[model samples]
Every structure is written in structure tokens, then in C-alpha cells.
Target chain A: MTRLTRSAALGAVGMLAASAPAFAQSIDEKVNEAFANSTGWFVSFIFSPFPGTTFPWIVMWLVVAATVFTLYFGFVQFRTFGHAIRLVRGDYSDPNDAGEVSHFQALATALSGTVGLGNIAGVAVAVGIGGPGATFWMILAGLLGMASKFTECTLGVKYRNEYADGTVSGGPMYYMTKGFAERGLPGGRFLAILFSIFCILGALGGGNMFQANQAHAQLTNVVGDYPGWITGVIFAGIVFAVIVGGLKSIAKVTEKVVPIMGVMYVATAVVILIMNADMIGWAFGQIFAGAFTGLGVAGGMVGALIQGFKRAAFSNEAGVGSAAIAHSAVRTKEPITEGFVSLLEPFIDTVVICTMTALVIIITQQLIIDETTGLYMLNEAGTAIATVDGNSGVALTSAAFSSAFGWFQYVLALAVILFAFSTMISWSYYGLKAWTYLFGEGKTTELVFKVIFCIFVVIGAAASLGPVIDFSDAAIFAMAVVNIFALYFLMPIVRGELGSYLDRLQSGKIKKYN
Target chain B: MPSKIVVGFDGSESAKRALDFAVAQAKAKGAGIVIAHVLEWSPYSFLTPTELEERHKRRGEELARAETALLKPVVDSLKDSGVEVSTALKYGHIAETLASVTKAESASQIVIGRTGHSSLSSRLFGSVAGSLAQAAPVPVTIVP
Candidate 1:
């Protein structure tokens, strides 16, 4: 990690010095020039992110999938919400139960991993780029995400592997392979292999590399250049120290840190809104108008919906199956307990935090891009300023907060660094777990992957890996494609587990422990 | 000449019982004893190098002081019963560290607190004991 980080620092400095001439030219002129002469293959128009065809198809499928699964499961997520709360309280915990952390701690740990960056940075991006209607789609996406979380996490527990020494290892691999094998499905192994491959890919790029890159970027942006490799090396060192200690250490740290961060973040958002209380109504109006009216700056109503849904999907990551990896490590014998807790993730990440970010941006009147010459100039405090290196939206968000609260950029920077770092650390574990599952576990094998992961963090920070990020994002979402498909077949198993677990709850078998 | 057993206690009723089980087992088998409790420090990664070491030193001293108080009762009882006992206090990843100390001390087993998780609430949210038991590389006996 250290060696790779040093290399990254050298590379970034070289790039910065080389690009100094470009920096002095002013971002607006550069964006203007780029947009003026921009030309692409005509077929690219179909994928151009206009509202009608591109947006509706994806969102409609998601909504339909969410609706059907919700109806089929009989709104199990809602019915079991209270039960989830109790489970986290350890109301039914047995000291003798074999697991890593308390139910609450497990939820906290998983939340720490899921709830960051996505809520703050991802939400801002969605609304900033997608417009107000994006909020609606984000909410819709979150609603459907619950069903996905329920199905995947239930399987995570059910298909877990109990080692000879009594240690348990479980995830989609266990369920896809073992569950299918039980059903006499000959292709179970192949499907499971495919799922593991997807998980490893998603984990490394979206989970590990993206996270590390973002964290490094934020730290450098805030603290300025550290020995180039210093950020990556130090971050990797922290990850190694905790991961070597295994899940228990991760759980403990997450349990403590997640809550503090959540509170601080939410409170900041609320305070921002309270001060701008009058704009609350206008913001919601814009959100609804943009969502249904389709008169957004980018594309029409349809475009708004697509952007919103995509951002929400990107932020909450409900159906992606990444959260399931973290949630799978929960200690309960009942898979349903964690499933219920899993539902809360999207709510917190998308519904609450994302909404707050949208409100902050909209209430501040910063959502729209002012058109100057064929290029769109991002408005910061009524001035048309273009982003250096083309970072318009979320960085604009930081500027908005800085406008409102002096030194607020520093706060945002710190938050991003923490959020990015935590997300990267958690994703590293998730990716590594999937890696080990596919290929066998050993210290030497782990060391090799860890180095690669650390290297990607620097790459992510140093260069604009546009195609790579896009491909990785697609892969992350693509997990939903295979995952939701398998989920339809496995719904019954989840139903059965839910029934048995609920029956025990109703019978008072679990109440005595609390 | 049986090996000492390590048990973790966090002042819960179940933890007390787990402590009892470890002490009793160690006494019965004529082995030594190690009692451990993990103090969770927040945001240690963000701390400066000097601050981190200082906090570590402070925690070590605190552990040393707490160790005598926590183990005195068990040690007195075990000595009276002609059983040799030793206690240790460590920080960070209690389960893995316990597993390491279990092997280090050549202890035969580990006794851990298992608050009842079969209740209604546990069915909905979950419990940590099962994961700990599953992840630990030693035989773990959970005391409810």
C-alpha cells in the first residue's frame, strides 16, 4: 500500500505540473470550447440520457419489480419493522448464540459502510445533475430497494458456511450454489460462480478503488499534497490493522463511528434547512414540478425521472447486493432479523440524507446551470463559474455550503474524507471476502489483492477514469440484474424463514432475553 | 498441569456467569486463569502518532489497575482451593485476541457470554454471539 501510494503521489504531482497551463485558462472557456465542437456517433443519442426511452424503461422495470416483490412478500418489510427494532435492542438475543457482534452493532457496522458518501456526495450529484424530479425517482428507487435487501440478506444467513472449527462464512455464493444444489438445479454452481465474479468486480472498483480514490481526493483537496503516496499508504495501513483483527474489530469500530457520523451529518443538514425555512416549500415544489412537469434544464420530464432514479439507485444501492455482503456477517441464526434491519439502509441513505442534500442545494437556488454560448455554466452565488477539471455539481454543493457557513468547505471536505475512507475500508473487506470465496483464503493471497486495491485508490484519484467508473457503476447496478432474477426463485425460502422467525417472536420465545 | 482458560467479562450477568465457568473449569482442571475486558476507543485511526501512543499507554495502565481489582476475588478463591490463577486485560478485537491468548497460554477452551437471543426481539434484528463463535478459531462455550 505504501509503495503504491508513493508512486501515485509522484504521478499526481507530475500531472498537476503538466496541466498548470490548462488551469490558468479558466474552466468556463475550456468547457465552452469542449461543448462547442463536441461530436459523437449518432447512435450515442439513444443512450444520451434523454427522458423518454432511456429513463422510463429502466425506472418502470425497477418500480414493477419492487411492486411485484412487495405484493408477493405481503409487505414483509413493513410488517417486520418493529421486530427489527427489537432485534437490534437485543430483546431476543441469546448469549450462547454464535456470532460476531450484537444485532445492533451489526446493523451499525453495516450502516457505517452503506450510509456514507452515497447519501452526501451521491445524493448531491443525483439532484444537481438530474434536477428536482430526481428526488422523486430516488425515493421510488429506495422504496423498491427494501425488497431486494430482504431477499439477499435472508439468503446470506440461510446459506452461511459453518467451518469445521464452527466458524461461519456465508453470502450470495452460499445461497446461489448451495440453495440451487438443493433444488436439483444443475447450473447452480455456474450461477454462483457468476455471482461471485460480479461481487469481486464490484467490490474492487466501486467498493475499494472508488472509495479510496474519493477519500484521497478529499484529503488532498482539504489538506493539500501529502507525500503523494502518504494518503493511500496510511489509509491502507489503517485497513490492514483492523482487518487483520477481523470482523469483530470492524464491527466495534463501525458501531461507535457510524452513529457519531450519522448524527453529525443529519444535524448539519437539518440546521441548514431550518435556517432556510422559507425555501422548504419552494424546494419541494421544484422537486414535484421537475419530476412530473419535465421542464427541467436537462431534458424533459422523462429525463428528470431517469436522472432521479439513477442517482437514487446509485446512492441507496438497494438491489446491488453489496450491502448484503456486510449484513451477512451479522450474528443471528434468524436471517430475517438482519433482513428487517437491512431495509432501514435505503431509508436512511436515500430518503433522509439524500433528500436533505437536495433541499440544501435547491433551497440555496443552486440546482440549475446557466446557459452561456452552447455550454452550461454552473451557477455559484449568481455568478456563472465553470468547474476546473469539470467538477460542477457536488463541488458546487460544497461552494453553496461555504457560501452559507464560513469555513463550511472544510467541514464538507472532512466529511467527504471520512465518508470516503470508511466506505473504502468496508468495501475492501467485502471485495476481499468475495475474492477469498472464489479463490481460497491465505495471507499471501490476501496481501496481493490488498496491494492492488490500494493502487486503484491512487489511480482513481490521479486521473479521470471516466470509462472505468462508468463500467464499474454499471457492473454494480448489474448485480441487481442477476440478483433480482435469482431472488424470484428464492422468495419462498425467505417467506418460510420469515414465518418461522415471526412465529417464534409471537410465541414469546425470544422476549425473555431482552 | 492443565493449561489456563481465558474468559471475557463485561459486567453483565451472563458475563459474570461466563467468568464463573472459566474460573471453575480452570480450578477443576488445576490450570491458571486469564480474565479480559475490551475497552473500545473511538477514532483511533485519526489520532496523531504521539497521541495514539499516549492513549495506548494510558489504556495499558488502566487495564493493569483494573486487572488486579477484577481478578482479586477469583484469585483469592482459586488460591484457597489450591488453584493457580492469572488475569490479563487487553484492548482491540476481543474475539481474535482471546483466540490468540488462548493459544499463547495453551488454554484448552474459551467461555463467552451469550445473552439469550432466541427471544422475539432477536428474531427480528439479530445477535453477535453466533458470529463470534463461528469466527473464533477455538472451541467457545457460551454462558447464558
Candidate 2:
């Protein structure tokens, strides 16, 4: 059986590679054009500006929700951060608790979904457009976003459906519906359905396509440009195999992949930062100065804040309510413990990892700031920019790292691909949960969604960035729009859960076996 | 009506030794012997609904296999013996499950093998025998 499985896997890879060239350039262009045209209207509307202001209202929707949750919880994210670490360490877990995965495994699985290309490429984009000051706002946003995660995840576990078979299904869909019912609130069902719809779309767009798209870009940057469909086919096959094997397979892979990729990426960044240790102080000064004074970048302080907040939301996904789905699976009778553990996701993904990427870019002097004007140099299109081989995003990050070590681009490429792969695997699960919730749970329904999701891997790879980014942003932000509403109503429940858990913990009623 | 002694059995050499020790103790005390085999099964958070469903089916199969293939033969051979013998199969943390089975059976003491599979993991996390010694409700005897 092992030999047969191995051969089958090898055959799939061989078939993918053998069929690559058949995907013509014209077809790629057509797919890209079709996506751009079809998705433009919805994308523009979802990201439409607030009345008489340039700011995207969806971004503000997330920011305001995060800030409010932060204050409402009395900064639970900070106060419980240590306890959260202990929970993940299985210190507070009862071996007899009726749940599927361990706290650490759930945290790892959720982290895999969030800590992807956003850390590598998105940070560069934020730094590019918003300038170094964007890093400041990004960190701030990540800190506030932790509170949002804590609230949604606590409610997620509180209202989760535990089956007789010991399986669990939870997320915004369950919490929004069941939680609202418990509170005697109307429209719980409607809100849940809305959240599910957005989650499914978000899974397809941000989770699958955006990852496939970025992975393709990174691969092409390392190797010569090949058709995106080739990358898509290979990724689709691997992803399908893991997802079909179900959550255990996905978790097993992510548990290993997330740690390795995170360590490798962070370690490389640390080495680079230390190599240029002399400039570390200067980089912080630049970030702080640019944050307030705009550093002469286009749009200045406001632009930096918007980009920082947007990308931080995109990267950590705290308010989007997806991580709650992952965290809810942890084995704990005390629902608030999972929430506490989940607050660490944004801190690790955005504050630590994203900041590392941003610092590397700033310290390396990659943004080409004009000394006299105190402004970032503009590209041919009149946009503030940084580039290597006319490549930006992950490529720009690659360039920054490669400056310290010439061979670093190769490592960055591999890390990007792994990050992309792990993210896709995790998102597939998140998307599947949402899919099952909406379509109803059955083998045929699940297979249909899984097949469609795999097909989107191809579409994501083949499609151009314009539509992919638009769709990803719209779907994710739409989830926040629905989720934050439920959170506003449900914060009291989370607060209660937190208060009781903390009281028990303080009173020494909650025993720590480990 | 006689006292019962629980023996942790897994069909390994050391487990056979532990079983022999339990039998000797039972014979001396005029007690009965309950053979208990625990399959280490920890819940994973990463399983999907479908996988979880499938896992439950697999768990049943595993328990059945352990009963028929491992425990039944031993129980059958001991059936004719004068000392009373029974069997149990459970899925969970080995030491805790054994301790629970001992408590359930009202057994006076528990006997287990010093596991041969000691590695870095055992050193870091401690072995089942070591944990059993600490957490087991009854006195535990480790047969080397």
C-alpha cells in the first residue's frame, strides 16, 4: 500500500509537469482578463470609499471593531497572553476533555493559515506604498487585532456543536447562530448564513487563489517564467491529496511545515538584521518618524495608517473570524482557554514575523528614499517603489535578503512556496467547514466543494494579480463586516467566559497537570 | 468473591513476564486476574468531521483486533486454570486507563512491564510506568 501510494504520488507529479507546456499563453491572458473584468465591479463596491473620504470603509469597519474589542475586554490580549502560552503548552488541558486537537496543534494550524505570503510580500507592499511609517501602524493594528481574535474564538468554543462521534463544527456560523439564539437576539440565522457565504468565498479567494498566485510569482522569480497553470496543476494535486486525507493530514503537515518555515524565515531575517546590526536603531527611527510626519511619501501619515491597518488585517486575520474555526477544535472544556491561546496568533504572525520582514526592507535601504526630499523614489508609473529585476512584493523581499547573502533568494523562494502550500492546505479546511455548513454535510457535497476548490488553485495561479487581490480583499473584508456584528453582540459572553475562567484560575480551582 | 489483581498486557515479552507475576500473586493470594490492554489514543484537533467519523470506525476495528488477536488466546489458555481470569480493552493514555480499569474492577494492585521502547521521548515526557507510579490510585508493580 505504501509503495502504491508513493508511485501514485510520483505519477501525479510527472503528469503535472508533462502537461505544463500545453497551457497556451493566449489562454493565460484570456483567463486573467476574464477574472479582472468579472470581479472588478464587486471588488470596487466592497472596497468603496467612505463618504467624502479616500479611506475604504471596509478597512475602517475592521479597525473600529478591533479597537472596540480591545477596550471592551479591558485588554485581555495583554493580561492573558502568558496564560495563553501555558494553554498551548497543554499545561491547563485536562486529558479527559472532549475535543479533537490539542491547544498547540490548533494554534499551529491557525498560524499556518495566517502566516503566509502576507508576512513576506504584503509587508513589502505596505512599506512600498505607506512607507516605513506603515510598519508602526501595522504593529499597532496587530496588537489591537489580538483582542478581536480573543472575543470571536471564545464565543466559537462556547457555542460549538460537539457530535456523538467526538467531532466538532464551529466558527462564526455556529457562534453567530447559536450564540444569538441564546441571547434571544433575532437575525442570528441570517447573520450566520452571511458569515458562511463570505467564509467560503474568502477561503477560495484569499486562502487558495492569493496563495497560489504569490507562490507562482516567487517560483517564477527563482526559475525562468513558466505558465502559471503549470504551478497551479502541481499545487492543486498536492493540496487535493492532503485535504482529501482530511484535517488530520492537513494538521500533520502544517504542524511541521508552519514551524519549519516560520523558524527558517525568522532565523534568516534575524541573521540579516544582526549582520546589519549597526543600522537597527536607524530603521526604528525611520519607522517612527515616517509614521507621524509621512516622510514625504505620497499620501503621508494617513496613507501609512490605512496600508498598515489593511495589511495587518489581511496578514493576521484576527477580526475576520476564520482563526476561530481553527481554534475552536482544541481539546478543552474551558472555552476561554482556546481564546487565550488564539490571541497569540496575531502577535506571532504580524507583530513578530511581519515586523521582521518590514525591518529587513527598511534596514537594507531597499526603498530608495531620496535624501533631500525625504521621500521614497517613484517608479515609472509614478508610484513609490522598491524593486529587484523589476519585481516587487515577494521579489522585493527576496532582494532585501539577498543583499545580505547572495544565495538568500533561493531560500526565500522555497520558504514562500512552503508558506503558500501550508496556507492553501489550512484554508481548504476552513473553506470546507464553511462549505459543509452552507451545503449540508455529506460525502458528495464535500467532494464537490473540494474539487471546485482545487480547480480554483489553477484559476488563482493562472489569473492576474489585479482580480486576485481584489477578490481576496473583498471576500475577507466581507467576512469581517458580518463577523464584527456578531462580535458586538457576543462580547459580553466572551467577557463572562474570561471572567469565570480567570476567577477559577486565580482561586486555584483550575488545576494544571502538566 | 476473591480479590482481583489487574495486569497490563500487550503480547510483548515483558508483558508476558508481568502477566506471569500477576498470576503468581493471584495464586498466592487466592485472587482473580483481570488482563487489561490499553491502546494509546489521543484526540487530534486537526481532524475534519468526515475524518473523525472514519476514525471512530477504525477505533472499533482496532479494539476488536486487540481483543481477538491478542487477548482472547491468553484468556482461553488460562480459562482451564484454577485461578479466575477475565479481559479488558480500552483506548486512552495507557497508565491512566490501566489505573481506571484497576479501580473499576476493584483490583488490589496493578502489574505492568517496564517498557523496552525507551527513547528520548520517554526521557523527556517520562514513561507510562513512571507516570503510573505517580498517578495510579493502586499500588503498581513493574516487572522487568
Candidate 3:
């Protein structure tokens, strides 16, 4: 084992040396230009007009759907929040149940997928662009998103297909088709296919590619700039190994890594918050004040609202339907219990973790407001820039941590790699599932999809931020569009399931072993 | 119907010693031996639906493999020695599930191996034998 590892390390170094000339050729710029040119139309269409404003309608699609679900479920996310905790603790789980994993495992797997670069980098971007007020809206969106998570995951379990072998397949595709057919609704098959197609694209773009892109960014920032392709190749190789073992291997890694990384990152943020204890009150004040008054951002209240909702949607991914895939595998006879357990995901990913990142940035005084112009000091591209690193997004987040502890950038870099790795492996499963759903399941087809996924990791790393973020946002939002529509149609089924489950519980019919 | 002696078996050398001890106890007391293999499983690890399905399948394969390669040969040999024997394969927390199985089978005594893992590692990860000694519904004998 030692010899094999040494040889592998040597080979990697040799490859890096061989690729040295390619690094100087500006391959990332070319890839960025090519991606932007090819995908510009699709990207713009999905992120279409609020005319005279930068707000994309896709953001509204997710936010509005989340709000509607929250209201429609009579605030089920809040009402069942305690039950969700108990369910995750295995109080309600029967070991004899048919599903594959426990509720906690399902939640952890889903959380690992959602709680990646978005929490660190995306929050920084939101706060940078929309100012402190964006934090408030982001929190609200996360709260609303819980309802969306509840709605979809219930359907994920309710309408799931259990094969003769006892393995299950589900998500928007199954729910859309199966639930719609049960409801005597038309276009069930068509909508299922549409959702599956979007899921495949979204998994590749947002889940796999964007994670690799951000990880490469953080890596280069710490280790000094190299051709992103080098990071990409190394990342792709590692990701390929994990993902090729399939979901079990990925889950094993994510379950252990996600919780540790999350706690480590949040603990660091907490330490920073405590160290800047005097500024926390002032930070909250700015958040609340800027939320209402817009502070000094470009579009005022609207800009903050847009950035907050957009970033929150991107972060928690409540309406995006990917969590449904992970949640469906949980071992539970009561599908509604899984829904209750799943609602905690968005709260953890967005409301808790993302808030920590935002608080750290705010408490560190990362974003500077221009008092005279009533606007943020803009960079050449007109976006708000962080003063500490002269960079934004994840770099700004790194700077925030480094401000409190000088050596934290290295730690943050490690966290970013873990986050990126976990995200890629999870997304690889999501994409492969979608791929198999479309192309029919076989070893060859599965390998084909995995190979394509790994290649994109390199492409994503070798591309500039503009095209990568744009494409990711577009693909992910497109998935939300399809998934939310299916949810709207299928929520009555979820409502019924939740009502029945609650009745059994209230009547003391559902046995609790723990 | 003879009183039952439950033995935790994993096909390890220590487990072979444990089985021999259980056989002697069963022979002296004229009891039937129930050999149990409990696969340690965590309820906290994240898994995708596909992976979950694969795990469920792998679990089945593991049970079958244990039956064919370990339990069957041991059971046949014990039966040849004029001792009635049965085997069980289950998935859960090792000690707790073994205790549950003991109670369900009406087994009067339990036997397990002192796990080969180092003391430090066992302390870190929790030793099944130590836990079974404390928590088993019946008296447990540990064969080192």
C-alpha cells in the first residue's frame, strides 16, 4: 500500500510538470469564453427579465414556490420542527422497515449535497453585492424553503418505486409520474421526463462542476496560481474514485466528513463572532437596518432582496428537488417522518451555517459602504469588492476567517476541498441516477455518465468564474422551475400523507421504540 | 426441548475459541447452541437511495456468505458431535441486537470472543464484547 501510494504521488508530480506549459496558455479564459458563447442563450432565457433591474425571474420562481408551500402546508415546517428532530434521532424509526438507511443518514447525505461552496462563497457574494440587508432576506428564504423541502420529500417517499430487490428509485421524476397518474392528471410521463433531463443537467452543472470550480479557486488562492486544469485533473481523479464506488462509499465519506467540516467551519465562525463579540450587536443592527433601508447598495431594498433570495435558493436548494432523491432512501414506513426529518436540512444549510458565514463577514467589517454615494465601492466589473483581499466570494470568506486567526486560510482551504469533494461525489450520484433514468440502467451507460461527469470537473476548474456561475445558476434554476411545477401538482398527495401520519401519531398508534 | 446457549460467532480465531467454549457448556448442560453473527451497522451514515439499495443487496450477500462459508460448516460439525445447533445473521448495534436475539430465542446464556482489536482502538470505537458483558439479558462468557 505504501509503495502504491508513493508511486501515485510521483506520477501526479510528473503530470504536473508535464502540464506546466499548458498553464501559461490561458486555457481557462478560452474555456470561459467558449462556455459563455455556447450557453449564453440558455442561461439568459432561464435567468430572464425583471426589466430595468438585475433580478432574475428564476429567483422569484423558487422564492414564490417556497412561500406558497409554507402557506399551503399551514407552516408545517415550523409546526413539525420538533418532530423532525425526534425523527432524525431515530425515535420513530423501526429497524424492520424496508428502506436502505436511517433518517439521520438520509438527512446527512442530502445536507452534504446542499451545504457546499454556496454556504461559504455564495453568502459572501450575496452580502458583497446586496450589502448586510441581504442576510435578513436570505434567512427568510431559508425559513420558507423548509416548507418546500417538506412538500417534495414527502412525495419522494410516498410515490417512490420499490423494486423486487428492495432498492428504491424516486425524486421529482417518479413523484411527477406516479402522483400525477394517481391524481388522473395529464402529462405525467412528459413532465417526469422533462424533470429528469433538467435534473441531469443541473447535477452536472451546479452540483459537480460548480463545486470543482470553487474548490480550484480556493486551492489556487492558498497554493499560488497554477493552471486550474491541474486542480481539475486531481479533483476529477479523486472524485471519480469515490463516486465510482457508488452512493454507499460516497455516503460513508460524506456522513463522516460533512458533520466534522460543518462543525469545524461553524466553530471557527463562532470563535470569530465571540472574538468580535462587541461588534455582533452592531452587525445584527446593520443587517436589520439594511434589510429595510437597503443601506447603500445599488438597487436599494430590491437589490438586497434579490441577492438574498437568489443566494438562499442557491444555498439550501429546497425547491430544486435534489434532496428528494437522497431523502427517498431512508428506512421508514411513515414517509411523512422523512419529510419532517428533511425540513431540518435547509435550516442547517442556509439558516444556521450560511448565517454563520454571513455573521463572520459582517463582524469582520469585510464590505465597505460609500456614505456619500449611497453605494458600495465597485470593482472594474461594477460588483462590490472586499477590501481585505481585493477579492469577493470565497476569497472574502477566507479573509474574514484570516482576520481573526492568521493561519485560518489554510484551514478554510482544507474545508473547501472537503466540501467540494463531498459535493462532487453526491452530485455524481444524482447525475448518474438521472442518467440511468433516461438511458436505462447498465454498467456501460453508468460508466459513460461517470466519465462525462469527471471531464466536466476539469472543464469547470479550467473556466473563469463568470461562465461557471452563470451556467450553474441557469441549470439549477431550470431544475427548480420543473421541480416546483411538479410539487404544485403533487402537494395534495403530501398534504394527505402528512394528515394521516399526524393523526396516527396524535392517536398514539405509531409505536416509538426509542 | 433443551435450554439454549447463544454464542456470538464471526469466523475469527477468537470466535472459534468462543464457539468451542459454548459447545462445552452446551454439552455439559445438555443445551442447544445458537450461533449468532451480528454485523455492526451505524444508523448515522449518509447514503443515497441507489447506495442504500446497493447496501441492502450487499447485506444480503454478506449474510449468505457467512452462512455458506462459516455458519454451515460449524453447525454441521457441532451436529456431528451430537449437539443441536442453529445460526443467525442480523444487522444492528452489536451488543444490543445480540441481547435482543438472546431474549427472543429464550437462550439462557451468551458467549462472545474478546475482540482482536487493540484496547485503545476498542475504547475509542466501543468494544462489543465489553458492552455485551454488561448489558446482555443473560450471563455472558467472554473467550479471550
lDDT tens per residue, model 2, A244-317: 65535544655565678789889989998999899999999999998997787777788889889989999999
Can you write out model 2's per-residue Cα lDDT over B1-144, one digit (the tens) per residue? 789999999999999999989998998999999999988865433433234324434555677799899999999878767789988787678888899889889999999998777899999989989999987888899999
Judged by lDDT against the true structure, how good is candidate 1? 0.63
Candidate 1 regions off by >4 Å?
Answer: A1-52, A56-63, A95-100, A216-258, A369-393, B1-144
TM-score of chain A, all candidates: 0.81, 0.94, 0.94
Interface DockQ of candidate 1:
0.05
Candidates sorted by TM-score, descending order? Answer: 3, 2, 1
lDDT of 2 at A274: 94
* CAPRI level of candidate 3: acceptable
**Candidates' lDDT values, in order?**
0.63, 0.84, 0.83
The number of the candidate with the highest TM-score is 3
TM-score of chain B as predicted in candidate 3: 0.91
Better of 1 and 3 by TM-score: 3
RMSD (Cα, Å) of model 2:
4.5
Worst 10 residues of 3 chain A by lDDT: A1-10
Order the candidates by DockQ, highest first.
Answer: 3, 2, 1
When candidate 2 is compared with the true two-chain complex, its DockQ is 0.23
